[model samples]
Target: MRYDIPIWKKSNLTLDEAAAYTGVGVCKLREMSNDEDCEFVLWIGSKRLLKRKKLDEYIEDMYSI
Candidate 1:
């Protein structure tokens, strides 16, 4: 079976917003970022930002059923 993944185009999101969108606890998301497991996270001027495109890609790559 094949599945089509939706493409997201938003450039960035706050950590809290990403957590809410992904339904993952903020603490866990932070841990993932710290461990370098957050493929969607980027550092912008010392602030961490999440790319909506990357987050959607991560979900497609890791959670798509």
Candidate 2:
């Protein structure tokens, strides 16, 4: 079963949207964002957003490892 969130439909996704799209926890994504190597997070003022393309690339890299 697929859960299609409206925010996930966008190119830029918030932390929650990225979590839903990746089947990963929001906390994990936040943790990744804290890593110096993870440059996929976008900061707009105090809000954080993740690029859907970057998240997809991250998932692909994880599985390819």
Candidate 3:
């Protein structure tokens, strides 16, 4: 079996990059990062990064509901 991944999902993404890639807006992405239940967000020092794969999974889960 084989799987294919989008180019954007090949690495971690900063908040702004995530916004552009996911089209979810910067403010909402920030809110999701602060929300305790959001599992796709990661914070390092003062910088926030989103795991591209996790963000894709999260959006998929949301729409499956």
Indicate which candidate wins on lDDT.
3
TM-scores for candidates 1 onward, in order:
0.64, 0.74, 0.75
| Highest TM-score scorer | 3
Screening candidate 3 with a backbone cut-off below 3 angstroms (N, C-alpha, C), the clashing residue pairs are: none
Candidate 1 per-residue lDDT, tens place, 27-53, comes to 876776775666778997789888887
Q: Backbone collision count in every prediction?
A: 0, 0, 0
Clashes of 1: 0
Worst 10 residues of 3 by lDDT: 3-12
Please, what is the whole-model Cα lDDT of each candidate in the order they appear?
0.71, 0.79, 0.80
Write the residue-wise lDDT of candidate 2 on 4-62 in tens digits. Answer: 75764788888877887888898888988876566687888878888888878888878
Taking the tens digit of each residue's C-alpha lDDT, what string does model 3 give over 11-61?
778888888898898888888788777788777887888888899898887
Candidate order by lDDT, decreasing, is: 3, 2, 1
In candidate 1, list every pair of residues with a backbone clash: none
Stretches of candidate 3 off by over 4 Å are: 1-10
Candidate 3 displacement at residue 55 in angstroms: 0.5
TM-score of 3: 0.75
